[model samples]
Target: MGFLLNNRVGHLLIAIMLFVAVVAVLLLIAKVADGLRGKARMPAVIAVFAGPALLMLAVGLIYPFIRTVWMSFMDARSQNFIGFDNYVTALTADASVIAFRNTFLWVILTPLLSTTIGLVYAVLIDQSRLEKAAKALLFLPMAISFVGAGIIWRFVYDYKGAGQDQIGVINALLNSVGLAPVRFLQDAPGNTIFLILVLVWIEAGFAMVILSAAIKAVPVDIIEAARLDGANSWELFRNITVPSIRPSLVVVLTTISIATLKIFDITRTMTGAQFDTQVLANQMYDQSFVFGNNGLGSAMAVFIFLLVVPLVVFNVRQMAKNREVRG
Candidate 1:
């Protein structure tokens, strides 16, 4: 059985068959319930449908969330209640403060820069010659994993001892130009920006794809009318294109924000969070596993959840508003 399931085709076939079976059963139940009247019918339908969904949500999300929150208030061993000490330490500790600052920088810079580049590139390639090829080339970076990209960029930024052979492309270029090699990764503040640029590079492709679709969805008639009314290029973009794609913009920004907030792989792969390059997600890992401080880890995790919740809520509200407007 294991050998049979190990094959991709066999696994897909079984999954499809199982899904069809479940759907068939659900349809059969719905058909039978259609003939029944009033309270019993409604209750039966709810039991058949909503019960499983609710149960899964409770098991998957609710329970784990509650457990994490509970642990955040407990001690390192989770043996005694420590109140707000973990939270205080997470906020005030020097390492955590640095982590928060870096995270703030990443959150602010990544989405804005990536989205801006994507939007501009999308507009440029929207109707350009060889548009598909151009967009594909731009999006090629997204195909690589963050760790893989980090490793690649790490080589690009690799530094060597003075008077040694420079193997890194950047340093090699500098040496060829009769300049000194720059510490691209080892430098603080600037190194963080360099790392953020990597995320921007990957995310720009995603942003371009989404924003390009949004751009295409803008009403051709509306754009024509705006142009006929003497609206310049900038005016058309500002008033018509942007407003038309406002919902998509919200979605792209929020999605990028979420990705930025959860940034871990690149930082870990590139810097190992050394040299003052730590963020919340990596800090959470170091605290929980590396340093054996589960309580602090849980607190950091909860803090991350807190930071994300408002953005998620805002996104949900924006989606609802868009739906309402469409309706």
Candidate 2:
């Protein structure tokens, strides 16, 4: 069995055989159940189908969540139960407090900036002759993972000090205008903003793609009617386009806001959450793995879950409302 597992040819053969066997079994079940009554057949099929999924969900998601919640109430070592002390400690610690502030800023700024820029970009491309191509170019950043985007922007924000020739594009542009090189990553409040911009860059494409679809879905007749009534470009956008895509805008904002909250990779890759650049997700990791404080980490994890569930619920509600509107 070990040799078969280690052999790539054997592994591939086993996997193929298993898939074929499963298909054969399912067909055999269907054939055998063909003569069965409706209620009996549906029960058989659901037991076969949903049983494994329910079991896996129970084991993977439900159990782990329960354990984490329990652990959050425990001590750092998980030996003794400390109730809300871990939560208090996480809330009161200076670094954790900073993390909360930075996270709040990210959750607020990233969505608004990304959504606004993307909406504008979508609107601009809507009028362009090469609409598809323009939107495609703008949407290219969504193809890159957060880590990959962070690496690209890390060099863009790179600082080589004054007079030594700026390698980073931003500093180079500043140099061309005869300005001093600023430490883009080392500063406190400003660095946080710079880091948020990276997320915005990666997220803008996603927002643009969704919003562009919504914009195009606006009724051509309504737009024409408004135009005939002497409504200008700004009026058409503010009245027709904006109102038509309002639901999509809500989805985009809430979705990006949630992404911003759970953001970890970019911040970790760029600054390692150093210099007051830490957000909740990275701080959770830092507490759990780096500092070996499971209690605090679990608290942060629970807090993140609490924060995210509402945004997800809101997005779902908005999507449902959009569907109702369409209906």
Which runs in model 2 stand beyond 4 Å of their true positions?
1-38, 163-165
Query: Per-prediction RMSD in angstroms?
Result: 5.3, 3.7
Candidate no. 1 TM-score:
0.86
RMSD of 2: 3.7
Instruction: Looking at model 2, report the run of 10 residues with the lowest lDDT sum.
Output: 43-52
Residue-level lDDT tens digits of model 1 in 298-327:
999998999999999988898888789779
Model 2, 1-327: lDDT tens per residue? 777667988779898998798668767777766767877888667756775688779989999999999999998888899999989988999999999999999999999999999999999988689998988887888999999999999999989977798998899999999899999999999999999999898889999999999998998999999999999999999999998898999999999998898999999999999989999999999999998999999999999999999999999999899999989
| Total clashes in model 2, counting residue pairs 3 or more apart in sequence or in different chains | 0
Clashing pairs in 1: none
Q: Return the TM-score for each candidate structure.
A: 0.86, 0.88
Clashing pairs in 2: none
Off by over 4 Å in 1: 1-37
lDDT of 2 at 71: 94
TM-score for candidate 2, please give it.
Answer: 0.88
Cα misplacement distance, residue 212 of candidate 2 (Å): 1.1
